[model samples]
Target: MQPFELVTVKDVPEAIRAQAASETAQQGATVRFIAGGTNLVDYMKLNVETPRQLVDINGLPLNLIEPLPNGGLRIGALARNSEVANNKLVQERYPVLSQALLAGASTQLRNMATTAGNLLQKTRCMYYRDIAYGCNKRQPGTGCSAIDGQNRMLAILGTSEKCIASNPSDQNVALVALEAEIHITGPKGERTVPISRFYLLPGNAPERETLLDPGDLVTAITLPPVPTGAKSLYLKLRDRASYEFALASAAIVVKRQGTRIDHVRIALGGVGAVPWRSLEAEAALHGKEATAANFRAAAEAALRKAHPQTQNGFKIELAKRCLTHALTQAVA
Candidate 1:
């Protein structure tokens, strides 16, 4: 929306150098890199972001998906959402991820969206999305209107009084269930964050969202090999079926040994600040005889700590129902 300078970097090193120089210019001075530009451009238009310089990383070798040695997949940051979702290997090995992707925005948007961008896409909260509203995330120290406002789509976990914005990516929800690792490269060096730790809780700093540094770029996402990922299910409950954000959703991967559940991974979306992995729920079902009672108990354990707002209080029960149904379907 505002005037900006565009610089195209030839490689990762050059991009790093450019980022450091820009940071030295001023604190939080507008500087960002563009990949697909679908999310970034839209945010810029909304004035939520006003970067002075744009670095293009379109020429980098961060666009390929590689198979891991341990029978898992590592997805490059630049791999288009459509490409990754439609890949035979991904579809076969991580059907829950593929299903989540298919349930996201749209085919056209997926074609233009990158895996990294999807992870970094800003919250879809009406207050944060609109500049006119008082959103602490957009304008720190202002206020969060969604706290007491219409909050049917807000969060129930990792939320403070200042902010309740929910992470909007369906892929991240499935990644949490799969126990994925995020590979990041920055000025200091390279570091890996379990996708679980990539997103931060709103604790007292509602403005800060992720653990990424100012110039850090996501390299790849590595998913651990889970025997049940192929048979997993991602169930989304919303006002409408297609193209709508989830009011509550469940990603369930269950591995059964005979009639007993050997391993279970559960993650929730549209109900938390981050992709919420329910260890309590997993513990409830792990090594237990898979049954309707076990699934219901697991769902109850998962939602026990949920703190929902006035309008969204139903999310606790909805998430429970959804998780129960997902667990049943995944085992079937």
Candidate 2:
């Protein structure tokens, strides 16, 4: 919305240099990288994000979806969501990831949204977007209006007094469950960070969302090999059937040996500040009989630490039911 300088670069090194040069020239000015401008453009129109310089990285060679030597997958950051969801390899190996992607926004938006951009999408909290209200994420130390305002869509777990906004990414929940790793390149070089540690809780500093450093660009996401014959499911519960954000969603991957559970991973969305991984539930279900009673117990263990707010109390029960249903579906 504001007048800003735009630079399009062909390669990763050139893009990094362009961003660094912009920062050096403008002193304290902000610089943002644009791939698929679906989310950034909306924030820019509202003046929520006011980056003085934009570096377009669409020309970079980061749009491939390739298979690793160890049977895993490497998804480029620029790969569109629709492409990843419809890719035969993704649909065959990681159906949960594909299901999560399809359960997200409409087909039109999915065709334009990139993998890295989707991971970096901001919270949809009304207070954070509206400039008239005070928000710790939008403006640190100013106070969070969502604390006492309309917080039905806010988080119930991993929430702090400063902020209760939820991480609204369906793909991220699946990634957290699958233990995906993020590949990032910056001025110093390149590094890989596990998906579990990528997102941060809204502790005192809600403004700091991810572990990405200044001038760092995400290159790809790597998913480790899924166990053969593993059963995984992603169940989303929203106010409607389609084109709606989840009120409570569950991503469960279960490996069963006859009647016993060999391994299990559970990740929850729409109920936490970050993609909520349930290690407690996994521990309870491990080496146990995959039964309805055991599933209920696992669901209870997962929601044990949930602290619900005034209007979002129903999320506790909703999340439990959703987890139980997802587990049943995974086993079935």
- Candidate 1 clash pair list: 30-52
Q: Please, what are the lDDT tens digits per residue for candidate 2 over residues 1-332? A: 78778889989988877666544321333888998898999999999988888999999999999999999999999999999999999999999999999999999999999999999989999999998999988888889898789999999999999999999999999998999999999888999999989998989989888987667889999999888889889999999998889899999989999999998999999999999999999999999999999999999999999988889999999999999999999999
**Quality of model 2 by C-alpha lDDT:** 0.91
Candidate 1 wrongly placed segments (more than 4 Å): 22-29, 228-230
The true-versus-predicted C-alpha distance at residue 44 of model 2, in Å, is 0.5
lDDT by candidate, in order shown: 0.87, 0.91
Give the clashing residue pairs of candidate 2, or none.
none
For every model shown, the clashing-pair count is: 1, 0
Cα lDDT tens digits for candidate 1, 155-259: 987789889989888999999999999998888999999987888888777777788777787888998888742368899988887888888899988888889
